[model samples]
Target: MMLLDSIGSVFSVIALKPIIMLMFFVIFLASIGKSIGVRRMYVNMLVRIFEYGRQNIESVRKLQYSNLNSSDVDEVALTTKELSTDSIDQSSNSAKINNVTKLNGVVTQMVNGDTNNGNSVISRVESLILLPGVENCPSKNRDSNQQDEIETLEFNLSNCLDYVKSGMEAIIEDEVTSRFEAEELKNWNLLTRTNRHYEFISLRLTVIWVIGFFIRYVILMPCRVFICFVGVVNCVVGFAIVGLIPNKKLRIMANDYVFKHTFRIFCRSLSAVIRFHSREYKPKNCGFCVANHTTPIDVAILSTDHSYSLIGQRHGGFLGILQRALARASPHIWFERAEAKDRMAVARRLKEHVSDPTNPPILIFPEGTCINNTSVMQFKKGSFEVGGVIYPVAIKYDARFGDAFWNSSRFSMLQYLYMMMTSWAIVCDVWYLPPMTRNEDESAIDFANRVKSVIAKQGGLVDLVWDGQLKRMKPKKEWKEKQQEEFTKRLKGE
Candidate 1:
């Protein structure tokens, strides 16, 4: 009896009491629809910690550089010279001739300088003199020499230099592959692997990291997990009950209420701080709501304010349960893998969904895959083809708080949630732009690209023409062939 009493006391102190208190706190916040400045305070503290860490790192780096000697500097200079000499030696004779020709042209241009009209007068004069002589030459020998030169079609090694530069750029960092990876941060966010070796820069920083680890894993993780569990349970049970209602109006009301509050609970689980701008342009009535894709949590973040009918492929496991629950109360379109691939069928369904006056605006990520929040990839034309108002929303996350990007190819859903719950916070801004409609003369692809540019501009993200699907698939044969054709045109001076 004494031992049992001791175990009960320990359990109540460590787990039971905190769980009950946290549950009540979360419920109170959800009911009131306001936060009590806790998140703000936490963010301020993080800012101070990050500043301190930055200063310490700078000091350490300065100290290290101060300790470096003259010998090391001389050695680095000598090594650079040797590398340059080696490169020069390895070049072929043709490449050397090409380089010499380029050097000579550059020197000549510099010596002649530019005209007051900002044109290269010498170059123009030389071209005119050469052209007339070729066209109006009377000598048979000169004409024969010119004909031979034209027929030879001498291959300049310099022509292929552009390919070398492009190859080197790809080897260093290509645009498509980098968009699917994590966004690089300018400062460490107290998360592991977010930055390189910042935690070990100073003993003080290391101690702070240890404390943050305890706070995240020991305290915050448990509270977040519990809140998330409650939210999921509420979603499943609430939607199931709402589905049984016979009245469509009441059912929609109940569904909206449940969805908004439940997703608000989810936002709390990640301690997400979302600032929405231009709420006047928020989606209303049935239309297409398009946004840049960053992560799966974008749904929860947006749903916290407005109830949207989600569109996606049928998922299983945890996502499957949520999808099944959502479908019960709302009209969400979940397609089979084969059906999703049928563009005609997908477009038909989208048109049908928007045609109805009663349906909520369908939220679609037209990029069709998650980008790293640093850029917006090509938007698929299916949604734009359905013919409706396009409500473009731009979502940009602050990486100093947390990395909200979901690299689905690298991490599973569960693994992503683990990182989110452990993160300091998920901070982001959402901009709801004015509704756009396709012009009568504009094609579906053109309209889609237009909306994509709007969102990318609003979010300050790089607007890329590359498909996000390139993360998994190779470049299309047609795309490669088109590039080859362009290169040939350049070679022929066409």
Candidate 2:
């Protein structure tokens, strides 16, 4: 009994020591805003492994294809021989037709016995043959007019076909639906998110996958969970302390400090590697900082570098706890669902927030919903209408590392966080663009679009005009009506 007790005690000490040490190490790094290149080294090693796996997979695939090609070659030769025979037969038929045409000058003339009659016969035959790129030469003015009418009908039909093709494409892969899903990676990163089933491709890959699974689930997840717990506790405690301070200026300063450091700790929990560019244009006091939304983590990602007052609909559960914690320390605006839907009230709150210079810049994702990192969708005009200096920030994630988009409808916050913790790392680049303000003549919607275009251009993302809210609701009736109007115009040759 004594030996067992001693052994268990030793094992607990060995396990707890490293965990405690890692907690301190992470906290220290977060406080200093420094990285020791551990994540970079891990990423470099992963790159090498991915490259090695890709090369081996290619070699195996080539060997497989080569074997297939050997059998395919004989089948292809046989098919080619048969095709040649059919082509010869077709050529002979054409030759016979050409000979008859030369003898009679026109094939229809041989059957009709008069040139005028042959013209009518040819027209009738052409009407029966509805082949593309085939045209009948008309001898009379009336026949020519009829031919022109037929061509006009075809042109109109082709215009409608264009709409059909686009509709089909949308049905298969619509912009809104795709934006709500994970962005596809060009290469497999040894993650099971891909449809390639790359793990089973080779024995080496299988072994690597098993090892990676152990590292991600057994080693990294527990550490990340522990760090996340520490971060939350620190945030709650830090905010509670900050709330106790009575002096406004000192409280603001304390709040900013606590927010930035707490978020940095949260960032480290996910092993996030964020690179900020053009820091000179970061959001200032009493300004509206607009960004493209990809995930709920965007707040943490941005807060790691600069503190901003968040504005959004009040959420519940884990998100609610964090929201309440943040609200206690700062002047964050959280609207109930009913209040959020009142644009005038929401704008009023925003205007009040920005009017106060003491408040931090109000961080707003005018998109209102998360989009896959591939594109910037339509920006709501409410924030732009609030009349404040807009600081546009563009955030682009490296999906090769891990996808950061949050599909709230499909996965809950906890599920999304689990996936994030297990991912290799959240690597992204953030660009802070110059400050923008609405032009005197520019409407709020136009100003919003202008800002969105700038962010999309900076981030190398597609600029789209579709509302992000389409993820939850169907497109507005006005949009469908506009499309119908355009289709009618096209049909009328306008």
Candidate 3:
């Protein structure tokens, strides 16, 4: 009796207590403070850093030889100002060539002179003279009017140095402006405003979450556990029924009924409103059916309506056990992807499975992994190689109700199911597109892409060209280069 009381007290502390709700607000307030205080400090620091860089660039541009006479500087400045407006645009090609040669001679003279600590600066100024037209100018025009050429060269050289300085300053100014604008835009986007609607509903949603916490833990959790138990029992019964059936045809029929009917119930248990569109355009017998994979629940949604053989990787845990039950009751192929080093063997199996008239249409999620329902990733070519009609299936979930994307990297199976089961309803739209066949002499990859494009279009999802491997980790540079070379070789029939 004492132990029972202690257990009840613990349960009450977790479910009925307000401590968890208070913690949520506490963390939220702490985050608000940090965002306002620490965020501004960091942004100010960034602005200062950019300002410092701008100052350095300005100082470099303003650099002048300290030992040069004031009169020489004024003459250079006056000549540069006069020539600046129309020197390049209006000057004849011959005049420009003469100026360039004279400028080169001046640079040589500066190199041999006793210019103090401005040697590095002089070198940089020399580099700036090698502009587009300066390098290719002909030598025939180099002898025109030596006195005028000397004055023009000095003016132009000074003008070139000023131009380089202004260019650097302009670049730094643009970069700083862009950086600040980007930071401002980022801050604006990050600022979540609480409008009248949110203000009114914030308290209500908080109340709901608090109430939901208790209801989820106390009542719904137990019911979900019971439902899971029942589902496991139903699967076991399904396997046993398939095994006990005598005749081959009768067994297939019975297995179909059990698997389809049980999964339909399981989907309903999670409040999933599974709807199929264009049912009349079903896959032909002994044909291939490809679908966009959204979540593991796709299996249930598909099985409820269509009697098809699923081909997928052998998973573990509850999904694995479910796979085993599925294999027993139907002609499903659960291949171990790690052990699948022989592509030809897998292709042969797929071909054989779809070719058998007695077997149901082979269903393959050629995407090879679950995508977030926002985009259709590239399809694998293995299933597309089978010579027959291909039915493309596009699956989309209504995230307006609740997100149905199961990110395996973040959530475990049970955690994902908890979120799904607690949500309003898992709504899905499955479109069975019109059947298509490979064009004359089309490669498997091309055929797969063509089918994938159609499905992406119909489903209103982004069509990704990536091979689906980049989602795991970016490939190394050398490996990517090698792959490119190999692809080039294949295209050339090397």
What is the C-alpha lDDT profile of model 2 across 1-494, one tens digit per residue? 99999999999999899888977898889987888999888877888988887787676665555555454445545544555564567765566555544543432332322343111112222122211111221111335555455446533566556456555655555656767778876457888875367788789989998999899998889889988998899888999999999999999999989999999999998989889999999999999999999999999999999999999988999999898899888988888756636766777888888889999999999998999888999898888887989999999999877889888998999999999999988999999999999999999988998999999999999887778888778777766665666556546644
How many steric overlaps are in each model, in order? Answer: 0, 0, 0
Higher-lDDT candidate among 2 and 3?
2
**Better candidate by TM-score, 2 or 3:** 2
Cα lDDT of model 1 by residue, 115-176, tens digit:
12211112211111111122233122334554465346655666555556555655655667
TM-score of each: 0.82, 0.84, 0.57
Root-mean-square deviation per candidate: 11.3, 13.2, 19.8
Which is the winner by lDDT between candidate 1 and candidate 2?
2
Task: Between candidates 1 and 2, name the one with more favorable TM-score.
Answer: 2
Output the worst ten-in-a-row residue range by lDDT, candidate 1. 124-133
The per-residue C-alpha lDDT of model 2 at residue 192 equals 88
Pairing residues by index, what is the TM-score of model 3? 0.57
Q: List runs of model 3 lying over 4 Å from the truth.
A: 1-201, 208-221, 476-479, 482-494
Report lDDT per candidate. 0.79, 0.80, 0.61
Pick by lDDT: which candidate is best?
2
- Top-TM-score candidate index: 2
Provide the lowest-lDDT 10-residue window in model 2: 125-134
